[model samples]
Target chain A: MDIKLDQILFQVLNFGVVFGAIVFLVYKPVIKVLDERAKKIHDADRAAEESLKEKDAIDELKKKEKVRAEKESAKMMEKAREQATELKKELTEKARAEIKLDKEKAMKSWELEKKGEHAAMRKEFVDAVYAVTEKVVGKAVDKKAHAGLIDKGLKELAQAM
Target chain B: MSAIQISISAEPIFHLGQFVVTNSMFTSVLVTALLIVFAVCANRAVTSTSKNSRFRILVEFIIESLQNLTTGVVGTGKRAHLFGPLIVSFFIFILVNNWAGLIPGVGSIGIWEHHGEENIFVPYFRAGTADLNMTIALALISVVLTQVFGYSFQKLKYFSKFINFSNPLNFFVGVLELVLEVAKIVSFAFRLFGNIFAGEVLLTVMTALVPLIIPMPFYGMELFVGFIQALVFSMLSLVFFNMATIGHGEEH
Candidate 1:
């Protein structure tokens, strides 16, 4: 066996040099890149998870907003319906009052006309009676006293009718 | 017919001052250079974000696969990161060295030296792991790092595993374990060196015996052995590291 101390030492030193070269030149840098890529992937996954949670929260908010708007709209419709009913009631009352006032005024004007027509008929009857008397019983009659008596009888007949 | 010259040890190709540069050492240096070049290129490719190449993709696939294997054995987080590159480097180093023997010119192409009446064949390149020095170095590195990991993880508790005096039986077991740690180092060195060296010898002999179409199967077998040995070495190191951190009958 050719075992020599110096050669062994030299070989060991040679291998040691090789180990150092490989570690520095190859291993460390490659491992660094792998770690970086892994970290980046992990960060991307975490970001995606966060975005998903945010989207869920926004969806929940949207649902609540829609419900709130629906409730508000329903309340507005109810209020509008109440106002319409009130307006219809108020308008009906005013129209009824106007119709009643018009009916009363028409009744008053018809009654006044009937009174004027009765007065004119009475005067005409009085004038016609005086002419007839003059024709039938001619000469020596008292005009004032007979007229007064006929007028009183006609007034009594008009009041009874 | 020329006899097949198989040597259990690496042949010295040249000498610089007192330092002897063996063929195995020469190949190791070459492998190291190639690995460094590949690393520099890979570093450039990996660090850049503009374009992708198939070479880069294949390298990444292999690296990620090795990392995953380390993760499975050692568990992830920080420990895997620390152990992965070392384990991969071991595999790559041993694998390249093992396969280097299979190259056509590595064991065959050489110079003839006159030693008196006979000539000796001394190859310029030999498989690195086939040498005892290289394997022992690897084994020593593994064990030392294992101890370091144990201490770093368990602190004071790690030493108690080797030097426990709570009971006689426990003490004996501790001593046995300590010896076993040394045994582990020998085991690591021999297992790698034996397999790679034996394969080289077997190939040389098979070629010498036939010198024709028969050595092809042995070459294929060597390829498989080369890969298996590399895997075994790296995997064992990783397990030892894990065991050291967890330390004796303790749950991880």
Candidate 2:
């Protein structure tokens, strides 16, 4: 085959044009899109990772708050128990003191009643004896002298009974 | 039926001033226009908002595959990106041109012209790589671009690869290397041209022998050969480029 210099030159120039057009039209634009897609994916992954970390931190804070609340409530319950015990003991002691006072008042009233009864009994006995002596020996003794001796004897007898 | 007539050179179809436009050149121009149109459409599809269409996906797939093929040889860096389009262009350009002649009407539909007593047929389109001129041009471009890449990477130090003068044996080896570089042009041109032209001749002969079902297998073979030649040309170019652009003493 005959190799023509002109034809070769023509081809070389033709290829140069084709190469330039293809680069401008196809290669550059496609590569840019691909690069942009890759960048978007990378950014999305990073955002997901950061959000996950934030969620973890929030979860940790919630856990700490719950634990602290539980501890505070427990302390309040313990304090409530202590106060309840103190109230119960104070009420018991106050009730015992009131009962003791009531018993002393009842004892004092019973002794007064017993003293009145005894006096009554002594008077009755003196009257009975005076009547019997009068019937046996009429108007033998003075009433005032006998009255004083009889009162003295009756008081001793009543005290002895 | 008449005997098969195969010409070694592509027949001249028309003239432009003093310049002769051969059939292969016309077909090359057609291939160029087709590629440009395809690129524009692909570019439009990619830049548009709705790129999930099947056509767009296909376009993207093709470009990605070409990009992957390129990066495999040149590795992923500024150099790979820089040289990727040019290398892929070689594959597209050669492959389409190689297949263009195999079309039904391309070589068969032609005008008969008088040359003395006999009439010679002049076709309107021939495979671009079937022409020796086109292959030589492509080879020269590949080799020359390799040198340019080498210079860009190594500055003046790249010449040492073929011009060493330190010792007698080293000088001889350097001279041999320089000769090999020049020989590469001849080898590249002949190899592609020989394969395509022979395939053309073979198909023509086969069609003449049996016009119907006999040449079908030959057509399939030609298609495979076309793809293979395209791959070989582009891959060799890529290898040379890779070799040239690396540091002088650095291992690949």
Candidate 3:
């Protein structure tokens, strides 16, 4: 029936001390470990996801590089083909010019050879006529015969012209 | 004309340190002893093979019920095994204590004492749970035990909660958490004290006003209230233990 405020306060303080001590010693640790375990798992999962994303990004970059390399190789091959075609055309042009020069030289040489053959044939004709005059005459004549022969050569030359 | 004064006196049955040890206390002690004996003898006879024994059945029922309850609340099988025994013991002991008060003449009988012109019937036997001191003691024990188990389970990391002074906001939050810890103790003590004390007062008033069959309904209500108070006390203790063992981020 006689409840004292001081006694109640004392009991409250006592309980608070006891409760605080136990909480500090016990409850906090248990809950801390539980939270730590949960957080660790969460962090690990996040790390794994990040790593997977990184790997995927690397893979995508690699794919892009491969595609780019293929395109670059195709462009280079096309340029090489174009250069080869140009080189082939230029070489053909040079060869054609050399062949034309050789043909012109051969034609000039043939013309000179024909002119020489004509000169030789004219000389042979003159020599034949002279031998025939000597045989026909069949005389051991001297200046008269030669003068006659010259006069005859002159006539024949005039007639032939 | 004559002036007459009458006096009546009653003798106390037992005494301890200026305080009378009553029948209710006797019942509490008996029940507590019986529970201990049952536990010891049952433990002695217990084997993995003894499945059908009555004591084993009783214990198993209690354990299984606690296990089921905790597991349902906590959503973990591991914690059920660890915290089950305390919860079960608290439930059974408080249940027994609450019910023990309901026995006839527990808080009813008293030693009638006269002082001056007043006759006060001081009760020799008051229900232990009905007393604020006993309920508060039990609540303190429960709350303290919860903290102890929580610390043991959490280990060194438990101190980080209070000692973390990294940021001003965090420091304030930690202080708030400390305040909450004190609040938890208060809540535990007051919840039990309020319920049990109210029940006792209610029963006393009912009986004082109506001495016959009128108090019967109230008595039955008291029995239900007693059971509910015990259940609530034990359940709250169990919940507090569960809460203590689980930190801020730890929930199902």
Candidate 4:
């Protein structure tokens, strides 16, 4: 094969021009866009992943909060129940004490009334005896021995009647 | 001349236009067509959720590897996006050209001829990178692109890299930079030419020497060497590009 310098040079120049033109016009620009796109895609993917992770964290936190809230609510309910039970017990005990006190007061008042009535009756009986004795004694005697003898006779007569 | 030797030596293939189309050319055309078809089909068949089919996987692997190499060396900022496609195309083209050499029809199934007692085999397809002219052209494009990007990116600074006249020392540095640029072209051309030519020669010699089992291992090695050489050439170009774009302060 015969080697030609001109032919070789022409071929080289031609190849260079073809490749250079394509690179300048199409390849380089396209690659640049693609690269930018890749960077954007990578950034977006990272953001999406971070958001997903954040969402998971939020979900977990919500779950924990819910559980905590439930526990707190339960504790409050139990406390309220305990207070109510305690209050109910106190009120019931107070009412029972008041009923027992009223019962004692009523019994004491009834006894006082009975005693007063009995005393009054006794006083009346005494008055009647005095009047009767006084009348018997007035007709006779002003002496102490005479009065004593008359009082004794009247007491015996009253008792026999 | 023996009849058996004449039969082996005198097979002539057809021609197309000015270019003599032989079996090697046929194989190369086939390979090129296959690549185009693959690109088209893969583009059409792409889906979001589906795993890439076998062919698509292979193509994506090739493209992604190229992209990764570019990004790794040049960093993901500045001109990586700009130079990625150029670098990828360079790699793919050279890789295809280099791999084409290993096909059965390459350097074989050629137009055979007679020259007295010796046989002359004219190959239909010369491995594109193996040709000095082709490699030189590719090198020029790579180096020129480096300059273009540097100019566009740094503008006045890029020009000042070789045209500084502020002081004697600066002038001398400028001259040195100019000299380095020229040297870059030479180095690029020679590096690719030498590696590819050597690989071709090695394959040829190996085939001629053993013709049988020995060539198989060398073929495998040649494939590996071709891949490495292509990688090295492209990587070196990328490094040069990175260096150029980064300006004179940073080491490559």
Candidate 5:
């Protein structure tokens, strides 16, 4: 086999040129593309995770607000029930006082009417008695005797008083 | 007697200022120019946004596969990145050189040289790796680059692999390591040259014997051998690089 220095040198130079060109034109660019792709994927993952966290935070806030709203509604409902109870009690007391005043006024009116009726009946009875006495006296005795009896009764009553 | 003849050395085709250019050198130049053109085209085809073309896809596939292969051999971190491009380029160059011999006109078209009333045929093109000079140059580059990687990564610790003087046993071991390091260049050069040259000779013999239909299997075998030899050469370099990057005893 022939070993020539010139051929070895030329081959070395050729290889060096090939190595440099391939590394520059092919290797670097491919690696750069791969790295950029990896970085993009990493960024996307991070963004998705951040969005998920934000969504969870918003959900928690909504839950808290819902709970607060429910609590306020319950409190308002309780207050309204208490106010209704107080209003019902006030109305019942006013109704009872009005019924008591009506009953007292009716009792007083009834007493007055009974007194008037008794007075009228007494007057009638008295009138009838006087008429009967006058008739009997007129029929049985003289008018002068009747008048003397009446004066004698009057004098007795006065003495007894 | 067979009329076919094979030369062991790359035949000189022309001279430029006392510099002789061989048929293998011509092939190497052609391969290099083709690779450069391909690189430019592939670079243009690959864009960040989209890679839909078949050429782009094929180039991307090859780059990814080579990257993965280098990572597998050296490991998956910094050293892989450092040595990946070199090893991949070696593989591509060697594989192309090996396969370039399979072209129809390469071995068939030649100039006939007359020697004492006998006509001897000389081919115009031969595979680059079949030349001992080219393989030797590639081996030198690989061995030297391994040292460069070792020094760049391990710094002062790299010399400890060959300069241990604390004990006689360790010193002898270090000497042995140094000798083996030099031996790796010989092994690398001879292994590639032997395989490719033997393949070329085998094909020549087959073609001479049968002339047709019978050399097909040898051609197929040469193709397989070319691919495997390329893989083997690059893998060995990768292993040596990996060994260089780590501490001496730390290598498993």
Candidate 6:
């Protein structure tokens, strides 16, 4: 095989130039574009993950708020029930007191009416007795006998007084 | 009828001052030009924001494959980035040159010259890898660059791989390693040159004997061989670069 220095040198130079041209013209740019694309994909993934985490956080907060609101509503309902019970009890007690007062007032009026009736009956009886005595004396005795009985009655009355 | 003669040497096509440009050199220049043109077009097509064009996609595929290969061989991260471009360039240049040889007129169409008693056919174009000069040149570049990468990576420790003055066994091992380094140049050059030159001669002989459908299978085989040789050369170069960059004790 023939080996020439000049030829070898030329071929080396040719390869070197070709290598440099390819590296500069094609390889570097292609690699750069690839790296940039990979970076973009990574960034997109990271952002999506961050958004997911935020969404989860917000959902948790919403859940907690819902629970708190339910509890507050339950407490308010209980308070309302308690207040209704108290008002019912107070109204019943007031009605019972009014009925008792009415009964007492009716009893006092009945007693007063009964007492007046009794007194009227007693007065009527005394009048009747006096009339009967007068009739008996007028029928059976004379005027003088009547006058002496009246004088005796007057002396007994003075001594007794 | 005269017998077909294949010369081992590249035939000189023309002269430029003292520099004699051969058929192989001419083919080399043409291949380089073609590659440069392709590179320019591919560069223009590739953009960071858009990835739509077929050309851009093709280039990206090639570059990505090369990146993976380099990363596989040289490990990942910065070292892969540093050597990836060169390995890719070598593969492309050699592959294109190898395939370019298969074109109809490249090895067939040439001028016939008169020797003392016979006609000597000299092709105007030869495959770049078929020439010993070209292969040797490429091997030299690969070996030298390996050394450069070695020094750049390991500094003074790179020399320790070639020489160890501490012990007898270590020194002997260093010497063996040094011999192997030189042998690598021979191995690289001959492997490429032998494969491509054999393919060229095989095609030439087949065409002479049958000149018909007989050479079709051989042509296909040559195409496969060419591609394989290119891959082999670049892979070996990548291996060498990887070896050079790491410490001798480091795992491959």
DockQ of each: 0.46, 0.51, 0.01, 0.08, 0.51, 0.57
lDDT of 1 at B179: 98
**Candidate 5: which docking quality band?**
medium
- Candidate 3 versus the native: TM-score? 0.52
Task: Rate residue B11 of model 6 by lDDT.
Answer: 91
Candidate 1 vs candidate 3: the TM-score winner is: 1
lDDT of 6 by residue, A84-146 (tens): 999999999998999998988889888888888866754564445346657975654444555
Instruction: Rank the models by DockQ, top first.
Output: 6, 5, 2, 1, 4, 3
- Candidate 1: list runs displaced more than 4 Å: A40-161, B247-249
Superior candidate under DockQ, 3 versus 6: 6
Candidate 2 residues B192-225, lDDT tens each?
Answer: 9999999999999999999999999999999999
Quote model 5's TM-score: 0.72
Model 2 chain B: which ten-residue window has the lowest total lDDT? B243-252
Query: Worst 10-residue stretch by lDDT in candidate 6 chain A?
Result: A121-130
Task: Please identify which of the two predictions, 1 or 3, would achieve the higher lDDT against the true structure.
Answer: 1
Local error of candidate 2 at residue B219 (angstroms): 2.8
Candidate 2, pairs of clashing residues? none
Error of 5 at A150 (Å): 53
Candidate 1: tens digits of C-alpha lDDT, residues B22-135: 999999998888888878888888878977788778677767878888999988867797789888888888898899989999988889999899899999999999999999
lDDT by residue (tens digit), candidate 6, B1-252: 358878898998899998898999999999999999999888889853564788789999998998899998777887898899889999999999898889989977899888898788889989999999999999999999999999999999998967898999999999999999899999999999999999999998989899899999999999999989988999999988988888866863
- How well is each residue in B111-155 modelled by candidate 5, as lDDT tens digits? 998889988887889999999999999999999998998999989
lDDT (Cα, tens digit) per residue for candidate 2, span A1-161: 77889999999998987887778888788888878987999999999999999999999999999999999999999999999999899988998988888887887887787777766776677667777777777865566878888878777876897
Pick by TM-score: 5 or 6, better one? 6
Query: lDDT tens string, model 1, A1-161?
Result: 87899999999988887787777877776667666867999999999999999999999999999999999999999999999999999999999999999999998998998888888997888777777777788853465778778878798977898
Give the alpha carbon lDDT tens digit for every residue of A88-140 in model 3. 99999999999999999999999999889866865676567667766897844
Which has the better lDDT: candidate 3, or candidate 6? 6
